[model samples]
Target: MANLGLLIIRLVVGLTFVGHGAQKLFGWFGGTGVTKTGEWLESIGIKPGGTIWAICAGLFELVGGLLFSAGVLTPIGAALITIIMIDAIVSVHGRNGYWLTNNGFEYNFVLIAVVIGVALIGPGDYVLFYRP
Candidate 1:
């Protein structure tokens, strides 16, 4: 039952992150794709051009989400996701206060917490392979 619960969490969170990646990578699901996403990153002071940042972030979200959902290399995936969430907080949401309504870091913080929790808890019995 606990593994079942973990499976559910992994699927939902991982797929959601994948969707976010799609938005940045291919502009799917109402995403703006690389051009606009990059511009937004620059607007927010991420620097080094929007395209580069968008590519890196898109890859991170896509691959990390995949590994996370598959329960393979869970910690590595969590680390990738965690780093992006931290960047989201620092580069964007940190200034909005504490609520989504204000575009704040609450959601980012929750994601950070969730990924970190998964990193600590392990991917459980449903994983494709276990690390230890």
Candidate 2:
């Protein structure tokens, strides 16, 4: 039962993040793809070239989320997402402070913690990728 919950949570969150990444990286959801998004980030004075960082972030969120959801490479996927969230919290959210209501890092911080938890404890047995 606990495993089922974990698996469900992982899948939902993973797919959600993956969709967001797809929007940013591939313009699937009308998002400005990596190039434009990167340019925007550069315009805002973030580290690393806009395109590079955008690509890295997009891939991390997309690939990591998908893998985590699928129960494949669970550790690697969660770890990557955890690192990305940490980076976001420190670089982006931290600047806004830790208040979710105030559009701060609180939300991301919690998510990072969650990712770490998922990484440390693999997803539960309820999975679509397996039949056993």
Candidate 3:
């Protein structure tokens, strides 16, 4: 019962993060490649003028998302995402305030909490992958 809930949350969040990473890493979901994304990052003052940050973000989101979903390296996964969300709250969402309707940090804050929850509570044994 509880395990199912945990598994679902982990996987859904992990897959979502992976999808986001894929967008940047491989341009799978209309995500710009590292080169273009690098430029975009520079504009936003979020990423430096190189592909490293982009690569890191993509990998984190990609790998973090996957591990988070599968309940593998879950603490690390949640930590990675929690940190990222913190940055998001600090960098972008801070000025927006709370509440998605007003374009605020509420959603980002919630996500950060979720990631932290995953990290702390971990999967409830419903993990379907990473058999080892």
Candidate 4:
């Protein structure tokens, strides 16, 4: 039952991340694609060029989400997710306060916490791939 719970969480969170990445990478799902994503990244101070960062971030989220959902290299996926969320918080959300309604860090924080929890808890039994 716990494993079932874990699977559900991973699927929801992971797939959501995939969609987010697609939005950034390919402009799918109503996203602005690389150009706009890059501009936004620059607007938020990501630095060194928004296009590069956008691609990097998009790849990280897309691949990380896929790995996370498949339960393959779960820790790595969690780490990737964690890094990006932390970046989002510091670069964009931290100054907005805690409540998401204010465009704050709340969402990013939750994502960080959830991925950390998933990392500590193991990917559970329904995984398509397992490291140990």
TM-score, per-candidate, Cα-based: 0.92, 0.89, 0.88, 0.93
What TM-score does structure 4 among the candidates reach? 0.93
Candidate 3 lDDT by residue in tens digits, 1-132: 788888778878889999988998888888897887777767778745447778877888888888888888888888788777776677667887888887788877888888887788867776756453
By lDDT, the best candidate is: 4
- The digit string of per-residue lDDT tens for model 1 on 1-132 reads 989988888889888989999999999999999999999998877787889999899989988898888898888998889888888888888988989999999998998888889879988899877555
Model 2 per-residue lDDT tens digits across residues 1-132: 788888877988899889878977998987889888898878877856889988888999999898889878788888778878887877677888789877798988787778778877777776557745
Off by over 4 Å in 2: 128-132
RMSD of each: 1.6, 1.9, 2.0, 1.4
Number of the candidate with higher TM-score, 1 or 3: 1
Best by TM-score: 4
Query: Where in model 4 is the C-alpha error above 4 Å?
Result: 130-132
Model 2 is weakest, by summed lDDT over 10 consecutive residues, at: 123-132
TM-score head-to-head 3 vs 4, winner? 4
User: So what's the TM-score on candidate 1?
Assistant: 0.92
- 2 versus 3: better lDDT goes to: 2
TM-score of 2: 0.89
Q: What C-alpha lDDT, on a 0 to 100 scale, does residue 66 get in candidate 3? A: 83
Clashing pairs in 1: 38-50
Q: Tens digit of lDDT per residue, candidate 4, span 50-108?
A: 99999989988998899888888888999999998988888888899999999999999
